[model samples]
Target: MKRMRGLLVLTILCFLISSVTSLQAWEILQQSGFSQALGDIFFIDEQKGWATGYQGVIIHTQDGGKTWSQQKVELPCDSELYNIYFADDKHGWVTGSYVMGDGFILNTSNGGETWKIFKTKDMEMPYSISFIDNKKGWVCGFGNGTILHTEDGGKTWDVLYKPEKNYLWRQIFFENAQKGWVIGCESPQKGKFFDTIMATKDGGKTWQVKYYKPVADEDWWYPWSSIWFVNEQEGWATICKKEATLLYTKDGGETWTKHQFNLGSWLYSVKFINQKEGFISGNLADSGKGALFHTKDGGISWELTAEFSKSLRKIHFLNSQEGWVTRSNGYFYHTINGGKDWECQLEPKTHLHDICFVDRNNGWAFGKYERGGGLILHSEDGGRNWDKQRLELPSGDWQMGIHFMDSQHGWTGVSILGPNSTGAFLQTKDGSKNWSITEIEYLPQDIHFSDAQNGLMIAEIEGGPLVMSFVQTNDGGESWQVRNKVARDKELGGRRIPSRIQCLNAQQWWVMSSWCLSYTSNNGKNWTQKKVPDTSGFYFLDDQIGWFGSNRLYHTKNGCQDYKEQELPMPIEWISDIYFKDSQEGWCLGNRYYVGDSLERCIIFHTTNGGETWEVDLKSPQHLHRFGYASGRLWAVGDNSVVYGIATQAVSALGKQYITLGKVKTVLFQNYPNPFNPETWIPYQIAQDSDVTITIHNIKGETIRTLQPGRQRAGAYILKKQAVYWDGKDDKGEEVASGVYFYTLRTSDFSTSRKMVIFK
Candidate 1:
C-alpha cells in the first residue's frame, strides 16, 4: 500500500509539472510618461563597468559609454538606493535605504546578471560602497562614518571602525586591495560641512585622518561629491564649492592642492579615464543646462564641451570620443566623438525612473506615467523614436491587473469600485488600442488570465468587511460570478471575521492580511489556507514555488506545505510591491517598516527563479512607489514625477516624457456630526482601496476612537462599523474631549488625513 501511494503521488507531481509547462508565458508590456533621475556610477576598465543609484537603479557600458544598458540591482520594491562599486566586471557592491525605514546593501558575483543581498544587524543607509577585490569591500552610510568591511566577497560584514561621531560618508575609493580612503562630512556643522577624508592602510584595522581640517575651499561652501585614486599617492577629489568646482588631492593624503573650475556650476562628478584623460559634469550656473568638461592631462587643465545647463549629475567615458552623461533635466546626452559634442536622447511620454538596454539596438526600460501610475517604454529604433504605452492594473476599474497570453492577446482587469462609480473587465484584442469594458460590481485587485477567454479576478466586497473571489468570463462580457473565498475567515484568535486580500493571481494564488496563504487548483472553488511562516504578500510563479514579502522572505518550493524564512540584510521591514516577468525575471518594491518615519524611498529587487531567491538589479535604481509590467516593458512610478527606462537587456538611456492624468479638481470631504447623539454620516470617494481606515483623533494626534479601519467594498462610504450612537466616551468608556476633535479617513495606501470637527 505504501508503494502504491508513493507512485500515485509521483504521477500527480509529473502531471502538475507538465500542466504548468503547457501554460502560455507572459511578457512585459508598454509604458506611460514620467521623469527620471540618476545616482552612483562606477567603471571597471573604462569599457565595462556598472553604476547604481536611487530605486535600485543600475546601468552598464560595454562599448565605453557610447550607449548603456540597464542592469539589475538586488534591492527590494521600496529601497532608495545610494551607491555602487565594481571590483571587476563580475563583482560589485550596492547600498541604499528602505522605504519603510532602515538601509540596504547587496553584492553581485555574476557581473550584475544576478545579485545577492547580504544581511547585517547594523545594516542601515549605506550611501557608498567600494570593493578592492573579489572578496574585499567596504560600505558606508547612516549618520556615522561607519565602515563595514567584508573579506569573503560580501558573504559577511564586520565593523572595522566607527568614526568619532556621526558623519555622512558619501563616497569611498580604493586604489589597491589594502589602501583605501573615504570622503565625507563631519556632523553638527553650523552650515555646509566640508569634505573630511579618512584613510586605512592595514586592511581597515587602523585608520588615520587624511585631512582632519576642511579643505582650503571650505569658505566657498561646496559639498564634496566624488573621489578617485589613480594610485596610492596620485589621487583626486571633486567638491562642489560655492560657484566653483574644486579638484584636490594629496601625495597619499599628505598634501592637497585644489584645482580651478572651468565652469561655474556645481561639479557633481569627476572621472579619470586614464592617468592622462579625465572628465567633469554638473549643473551650469543658472543656465538651466548641464555642463561637461574634459581634460587630457589629468586634473591639470579642463575644456568645456557641452552645456545642457541642467544638472548633469553623472558622466561616463568609454574612450575620449564615445561617452554619455546623465542630466538632472530628465534626459541623457551621448557622444560618439568624445565629449566634443552631445545630443539628447528622447523617450516616450512616460517619466522614466531607470533605463537599460542590452546593446545599441536592443534594450528595456522601467518607468511610470507622469500621472501617478506605472509605465514601461521600449525602443527598437536606436532610441531615435521610442514607443510608449500603459501597464496592467490590479483591478477596481483602473485596469489594475493585466496578464499577457503571448506577445499580443492580453487580459487586464477594469476595476468598477468607486464612489458611486463602477468599471468593467477589459480585454485588449489588438494591443491596448480599442478595448472592451465589462461592467462588474466587485472591486477587483488582481487578475490573471490563462488564455483569451478564461481568467480569474480577485476582488473585495462592498463595505469591505470581507473580500470575495470570482472566476470571470469574457464570452462577450455576458455574466460574472463569485467562485469562492480563497480561504475561510478567521480572526487573530480564530474568531471568524474576514481576511483582507492584498494580492491575487490565476495560477497558484494567495491572499494576505490575516497572515495566511491559500492554494487552489479548481479556480477558488476549494481552497486550502496554508499557514505560512511569513506575514506579508505572497508571490508565486506557479502553484508550488513562491516567496513571502514582508520584514523577511519566506520561500516555499513545495507549495506552502512547508517553508523556510530567510532574514534580509536590509534594515527596513516592508516589501511594498513586486513584478515578475517570468520565473526568472522578477522585481520587488519596498518601504521602511519602522514605527514613525515617512520617507518612502524606492527599493527594487530582481530574481530569476520566480522568488526562490532574489538579487539586487543595480542598473536601474529609483525611488519608485509603484511598478507594473506591460507589453515588453516595466513601469515604475513614484513621487515628484520621477521615472526611468531600462532600455534593453544590455544597454540603457535616461530621459523624461511628461504626462498629466487630467486635472482632478474635485475634493471629497469627510463626514460630519461626529460623536452625535444618534445618527452620523461619513462621506468619502472611492479612488482605490482594498481597505480603508476612518479613525477619530484628538487635536494632539491621538487616536481618540476607531470609527472604522478595515476593508470597505469600493465606493463612497457613509456607513457605520461600530454603533452609530456613542455615549460621548472614548474606547475606555470615559467622556472624551468635547470641543472640536478630528476624524480622519484613509485607505490601504491612501490616507487623506483630513479632519472633521467633532462636537460633544
Candidate 2:
C-alpha cells in the first residue's frame, strides 16, 4: 500500500507541474515584428520566405503566413537595407546602403545560417538584383543603367556598364548569356511616357537603347517603378501614368502598348505569372493606402485585390500563385492565391514614437533623427498620406489644455511659469489671430471656467490660521470672490490638512485631501466628510458615485454617506490615479516594481461592474504613475514620459466595472476612540490637493490642533502624529474636552469641514 501511494503522489505532482507550466504562457491577440520599415519580401516557396527592411531587419517565415521570426544580421547601424534575394530556403543575399559609404551587398551560403558582405565599387546605390544561379548575378542602382556582374557565388563583382548621365536604370534581366534587357527612366525630363530599354546582344559587354519615349512634362521627376519579363519576347513595365495607364510589350523592347489598369494611385510594381494572370502594387499618392491590382487577360484589364493603409514599398513572387508585399511601417503582407488575399507580419518598434496616425489616410514617420531629437511626425488624413511638419510650439505660451466645442469656438489654458513668468491669461477668439494675454487677479494653479464668464480657480495661501481658499468669477475673468475659506488647526487635535476642489456642476463640487472625501451642495459652502480607503489613488464619476483604490477599494454610494470595501484581483500597492466615464466604466493605474528593482511595467486595472471585479490592463509593476480622462479618452503619463491611451468606449465589460475615472471628490471622517487611549485614529479624503489644512481647537476658541498644513492628493489619510496624542489633556496638557470640542478640515479651494468630538 505504501508503494502504491508513493507512485500515485508522484503522478499527481507531474500533472500539477504540467498544468502550471501551460498556464504561464502570455497570450495576446496578435504580435508583429519590430517596425524596421520593411522594404522588400522574397519567397522561396508558398510557406517559406525572407523579408528585409530598414536597419538591416530580416524576418523569415516557414509556415506560409502563420508565423515569422527575426533573422540575425551583422550590419552597421547606419546601413539601410533595400532589397532581399533568396535563392533557396537557406541561401540568400541582401543589397543595401553602406555605413557612411556607398552600396554594399550581403550573401548567405548555408541556408541563411551565415552571411558575408561584398562591397561594390559604385557611388550609386545598388537597388535591384537578378541571379541566374549561385555563381552568376546582376545588380543596378544610382546610375544610367550601371550593371554589376558577380561570379563565384557573389564573392567578387565587376562593373558591366555605366550608362549615360541622365538615364537611371532600375531593373535588368537576361535570356541566356547572349541577350538581355535593362529598363529605366530617360532624360530630357518631358514627354517620356515609355521607359528607356537597352538590349545587350553579347552577355552585357555593350548596350544600346533600342527604345526611348520621352517622359511627359507632368511625369518627369519619378522613375519607371518596375519591369518584368516572361521571356525574351514578352515583357511588362510599370510606368506612372500622367493618365491611368499600364504598359506591355510583346516583341522585346522594339514596341510598347498601354495596358488598361485604371487607378487613383500610382502603380510602382508589376509581375505576371503567365500571359493571362498578373499582380501589381503601389502607393495612392504618398499615403500608405496602396492596393494590389490583378489582371486576368495579360494586363488588358485589372481589378483591385488587396488594399493597405501602409505603403507598399516592394513586392516579390515565388510563382503566379504566391507573393509577398512589404510596407514602410515594417509589416509584410503575403498572399497565397496571388494578390487575392494577404496576411500581415508585424515588426518591432525602434523608437517610442515610430507610428503616428491621425485619421487613417495621412501620416508621417521617420526612421531616426541622427541629432538625438524627435524624428517621428503627425498627419491629417486617415493615414493614407504624409507630409513633414515642423515641430514648433504655439507662439504665446505652452498650451496646457485645448478645448474646441466646434472648430471656431476654442479655449486654451497657458502658464507663464517660464523665465518670462507673468500671470497672463491668454485667449484666442478667432481660429487664427494674435493671442490676447491678460493678467488676472489670481495666482491660480488650475482653471475650469464655464463658457466665457463663470469660472473656478484654486489658490494656496500661507499665513496665521487659514492657509487655502477658493476664489471664483462670473464676469469673464474680470472680478473674483472668496467663495470659501479652508483654514488649518481645527480638527483632531489641530492637525494640518490640504484640499483641492473639482467642480461637477456649478453648485455641486468635490474636494480631495489626504484624509477624506468632502462634498459640497451649495457652491463651496457647507461640506460633509467621509473617510476614504488609503492615502493614494481615487476617482469620481459624479457627485454621488466614486471609487477609491489603493491596496484595495473603498466605494461610496448616496452622495458621500458611507464607505465600503471591495475586493480586487491582486494587491495594487501603488495605485496613483483613477478615472471613470460614467457609473459603469472606470480605470485605476499605478506601478509595480519588477524583480530587477526597476519599474519596468505599468499596472493598469479596469472594472466594469462598479468596482466589483477588476482586470489588469497593463502590468509594468514599475515606478510611480498618474492617469486622467479628458474628452472620451483616458491618458496615463509615467516616469519617462511614457504616454498610453485607450478610448473609453473600447473598454471591455471588465473595464466598465470601474465607475470612477475622471471626476474628483473628497471626504473626511471623525477620529476613532474619542473616549480614552494612548493612540487614536483619524482619517480624511481629498479628490485633489489645492491646499488642505486640519486643526483642533478648545471650547475657548484657542487653536491647539494642526495637521497637514500644505497641499495633498486624493486618497485617505491616517494621522498618528505623536503631537496629536494628548495625555488626556488639553492644549495646556491638562485634561479637557470632556464635554465637546471642535475640529476643522480645510482645502485650497476654501472649502472646510467641521466635526465635533467628546473626551472622557
Candidate 3:
C-alpha cells in the first residue's frame, strides 16, 4: 500500500510536469518604453480604464491609473490602436489604423478579459470610434473619407458615408443616438485649407457643415491633429498651422470661441469632465515651453498645469479631479487633485529603432533622441535586461542606423533636421560602453562595416541636387572621403518612393527607390540598376542567390542574372524583410490576406528548402515590420515597440528539412568508442546556422581544449556525411591523462554538455 501511494504521487507529479511542458510557447511580447505614446485612453468609472497606442498596445489599469497591465492582444504588424471607447467595464469598443492597410475594431464583453475581433470590409482605416451604447456606434477616418456605422453590437458594419474624391476626415464623436460630430480638413483647388466640422442630427440620414475656419490653422506642415466633445453643443478642437489654436463651441456648433496662446507648442488632445471643467495637452512644435493646460470655468480662462520635455500624445480624466496623461518619451503621468499635483507611473519599454546582436550574450539597440527612444542600450545577458550607454552626438539628433560587426566595434548614423540639419557618424571601439562622433556631411542614408576596418557609408552630398555620395572610412571612421556621387535621378523615381535600405557586409549592398533596384559590389564606387516594377523588398543569401519579396515572391539563384516570379496560395500585399540560415531554412515577413478572413494580416513565411516550399510561421494580429537574427535567436520588432523572439532550442523545423534531416532538430551525440585507445569521433547536428562551440573539461571543471569555435552555418548533419574528429588530443595535440571528461555543445538558443569516460 505504501509503495502504491508513492507511485500514484509520482505519476501525478509527472502528469503536471508534462502538461506544463506541452504547450507551444510561440514568443514573448515585450512592451518597450516607446509604447507609452498612448494614442487614446478610456476610463470606466475611475477604476478600470484602457489605453491603446504605438502599435496596437491596449493596456488596462484597475487601480485608477496607478498601475497598468498589458493585455494579450493578438494584433498584426504595424497595428496601431489609436482610439478606444468603453460604455461600461464589461462592454467596449476600440479602433485603430494600420500603416500598411485598413484599420481594426476590437470589442470586449467581459471588461477586456477577452476580446472578439471584428473586421470591416475593404481597406478602411478608422481613426476614431464612438458608441452611444454597446449596440449603436460610428467610425470615421481617411478611407477616402471613410465612415462605418453598426447597430448590431459591431457584428456588422454598413458604409454610411464616403466623401467625394480628395476630401479626408477623422475624430468622430456621437452624443446620444441622433447627433454626431467630426472634425478634419477638406478644400477645393486654389482654395485655402479649411478647419471644418460636420454634424449629423438625424442619425445617418443627412449631414451639415456647422463650423469652418477660412484660413489654415497654426501649423501648415500637416493637418490639424485632434478633436473632442463633452456633449453635442459643447466641444473643443486643437489645431496647428504655424502656431497653435484652441477652438471651443457652446451652441451646438452654431457659435464658437477661439483662444490663441503662446504655449509655443501644438496641442493634440482635449478632455472635459463637465461643461465647466476641462484640460488639454500636446507637444511643442519647436523647442519651447508649456504643454498641459487646465480650465475650471470652461474655455473662458486657462492656466498652465504641467510641462513635459517632449510632446504629449493623449490625455484622460477619470473624474473632475483624477486624470492621466501619456507622452511621446514613454512617460505616464497621473493627477489626483486635478493638475495641482501629479505622479509618474512606470512601465518597462522595449521599443528601439535599430537593434543589433554580436553574440549570444551581447546586444545593443538605438532609437530616437529620448528615453527608450533614441538613446543607446547594451545588454550583456542576451537582451533580457538593458542598461543605458552614453552615445556622444550633437544634442537633439536621432539615430537612424545602429550596426555592429562584433562585440567591440560598431557604427551609428545620427541626423538633426531643420535649417541647421547636420548628420554625424559615431563609432564605438569598446563595445557600446561609449560612443564618439565623426564629421559626416549631409545625412547618412546607409551605413555598413564589413569587418573591423573595411566599411562603407552612403551620405547625401552637401549642398547638392538630391545626390547620394559614396564615402569610405579605412581606419574605422577615423577619416572619410567621397568615392562617387549617385544623383537622385528623377526618371528612376516618380513611382513609389523607396525610403529604406539594407547593407550586407561592406562589399555587397542593395537599395530600392521606387521601381529602381540598385546594387553595388565595389563599396558603392559603381552601381548596377535593375528596373523591376512593383518591387517591395529583397534578400540575398549569397552573391549568387537572392529572393525578392513583392506582392509575389521572386527568386534569382544566379544573382540578378535571372529572375523567376512565383505566385503564393494567398494574396500578399508587401514583404518588409527576410532572413535565411541557409538554402534549407528561411523566413519572409510581410502583409497577407487569407481566404475567409475579413481583413488582411501581418504574416511570417518559413521555407525549408530555400524558397521552394513555404508555410505560415506566424499570422499576427499586430503588424511586425523587421526581424533580426543573432547567434541562433530570431527577434521581431514592430509598431508598439514590442519585441518577439525565439531561441535555438525552441527552433522546430516541423515544416522543412536540412539535407534530408533525420529528426529536423538540434542533436548532440555522445562521442564514439567510449573506452577507445587514442581517438574518437564527436558528432552533432543543428537545424540552422548557429555559433557553435565544443569544449572538453576535466572532472574539476578545468578547460582541456576547444574542438570547434566560430560560426557554423547549417551543414550536413548525418554522420559520415560530415563529422568532427577528436584524436583524444588537447590544444597542443598531446594525449591527455584522462579519467572522466565532459564535452559540451553551446549555441545561442541551446546548450548541453555530456559526461563520458576517458580511460587511458
Candidate 4:
C-alpha cells in the first residue's frame, strides 16, 4: 500500500509539469521596429543620454549612444514628446503635448528609473526646453507665443512671457539665469509669416525684439528650427526651407548674418562645441536622405560628412570627438571620431505593405524604408527571422504588389517616381536570387496569379482618358498584353479608379475600383459592373461565394447575382482587407474610428459560421495593412516593420468551448503583489489544450528566465496554488537587480506579455 501511494504521487507530479507546458496563441514574429519619429536628444555626459519621441517613448543609453534601453512612461496614447533636458545624471525633464492639446512635463529624479508627470493646463503644446540647473528651466512653443518657466523642478509652472497674437516660438536658449533668447515665426495675417528673434535681460521679465526678417512666404518656411548658444556673445540658428540657411550672431543676437547653401535640404538642429567648430543635421528635400555637415570655420563653409536614408532630427555633442545624432524613424547614431564616421544603434526602419508566402517556411514582405528606396524582406522557418534581399532601384521608387506561384517563381510591381516617371514589373526565377525588370506604360496597382503562367494585373494610366487597364501575362511574365480598359466614371465625377484585382482561373477575373465592382467571365475581355455601398475590401472564395466590405458587410452566394447584408459583433468604420479559407471560416481587417482622435484603431474579426456572425479575434495599436494564410497559420504585416502569426487550428478547436464556456478567451493576468521582493506568481488562462511557457526579460529585452510547465488542458490557472511561481532568480540561479521586467505567457496559439516591477 505504501509503494502504490508513492507511485500515484509521482504520476501526479509528472502530469502537472507536462500539463503546464502546452498551449497556443498569436505570436509576434517581428517587432514594430521603432514606429515613432524621434524629436529630441540630450546627453549629460559621454556615457549617459536620453532621447524622446512620439508615443511617449523614452530610451536611455549608458555607453553614449552605442546601445539604448527603453524607459517606461505612463502617459495617454498618442502623446508626443518633443524636447529633453538633463541637469545632471539623476535629474531630468521632458516636455511635449498630450493628445488633447495640453502640454506636460515628465520629471525623473532617479536617472529615469521612475518618472512623475505634471500637466500644464494653460499651455497649448510646448516644443523646446532649456535648463540651467536641476530646478530652474524654461519651455517655449505654440500658445500664441507663450513661454513657461519652472523654478521648483517642474512641480509648478508659471507663464513667463507672451508675445504677439500669432507668434509661434520654436526654440529657446539661455546662456545664464538672467540672459536668454527665443526664436520663432510670426504671422500678423493669414498666409504671410516671417522669422523673429527676441532677447530677455531680466530673466524673462522684460524682452525686446533683436531681429526680424520678412519674406514673401512662397514655400512657407519655418524660419528657426533650432537655436544654440556657445556663449552670450556668439550663437547660431537653423532654418527649414528649400535651401539650407544658417544665421550667425556675434553680438548677443543684436545683429545677424545669413549664410546660404545650395544643398536642397531642410536644416533642423545645429550644435557647436566651440566658437570655431559646429555640426548641422537635416534631410535632403528631394530624396529624404539624412544629411550631416561639419564646419571647422564656424558657419562660413561646411562639408558633407555623412548621409543616411532617414532624416536626421536632433544632434547632441559632449565634445568635438564624441556625439550622437537621432533619425526621424527612432534610430540614433554614435560617432567617436567627430563627424567623420558613425554607427547606427538600432534596427532598420521600414514599412511592410504586402506579404506573400509560397509555403509555411518560405515568405517575402515587400515595402519601403522610412527614408526611401524599395525594401524586400525574406523569411524562412515560418518568419522567425527575416533577411533583406537586394533589388537595385532608385531612391524614389517603391514596391506596390507581390505574387508568388511557387518557391522559385515570383513577380513584384515597382512604382518609379522622378524625371520621366513610370512603372515596371520585376520578375524573378530561382527564388529571388536575380530579378529582371520589364518596363511598362502605367503604374501597376494590383497583381494576381491564377497559375504559373496566367496572371492578371490592374494598371493605372496617367494623363489619359482611360483611367485603368487590365494587363495579362501568359508565358510566366516574360511579356504582358493589355486586354481591357476602364474609363473614368462620369457618374462619380471622374474619380473611379481600380484599387484591387483578383483572379479565380484563366477565364474568370474580378476588379474592385473606388466606385464599383467589375467582373469578367471570359478573361477580362468584357466586364459587368455591380454597385455596392463602398469598395474598401473584396474577396471571392470561389466562383460562387464572395464578400464585400465597407462600413457594413455584404455577401453573395451565387456569383454576385444578389447580395445580403451580414451582421458584425462590433462596430468597425472601414474594412481594409478580407480573406476566407472556406465557406465557414473567414477573417476581415478593419479599423474603428473615434470622434476626436486622428488615428484609426485596427481590429481583426473572425467568423466560424460564415457571414451570419463574427467575433473580434485580435486588436493592434500599429496599423496592419494586409494578411495571408498558409500552412494552417495566418500571417499579417503592417507599419513599423511588424509581422504576426497565429495558428488557425487552435481557434477552430476552441470554437465549441467558446460557446459552452461563456466565450472564454485566453488571458495572461498581472502578477500578484507587484513590486515584491524575491518572489512572485504568474496566473493565466488558456482556451484550449496547448503548450505553455513563460519568459522573463529585463528592461533591455534580454531574457533572464524561461519556465516550461508542459502541456496544459483548457482551464483557468488563476488560483495561487495553480499558478506558475518564480523565485526572482535568473536562468543560472542568480538574483536579479531591482528594476522593471517583462513577463510573457506564450501558448501554441496565443501570447500576451505584460510588465512587472521588482522593488528590492
Query: Which one is best on TM-score?
Result: 4
Better-scoring candidate (lDDT), 1 or 3: 3
Q: Which has the better lDDT: candidate 1, or candidate 2?
A: 2
> For model 3, how does the per-residue alpha-carbon lDDT over 488-517 read when each residue is reduced to its tens digit?
644221222223456675677776543556
Backbone collision tally, model 3: 29
Residue 387, model 3: Cα distance from true site in angstroms: 4.4
* Steric clashes per prediction: 140, 103, 29, 27
Position 7, candidate 3: lDDT: 10
- Per-residue CA lDDT of model 4 for 50-115, tens digit only, reads 988887889898976666688989986559998898999999999887654577888999999998
Global local distance difference test of model 3:
0.65
lDDT of 1 by residue, 177-210 (tens): 7788887766432333446777877767777776
TM-score of each: 0.45, 0.45, 0.55, 0.73
lDDT of each: 0.54, 0.55, 0.65, 0.74
- From the highest lDDT down, the ranking of the candidates is 4, 3, 2, 1
Worst 10 residues of 3 by lDDT: 8-17
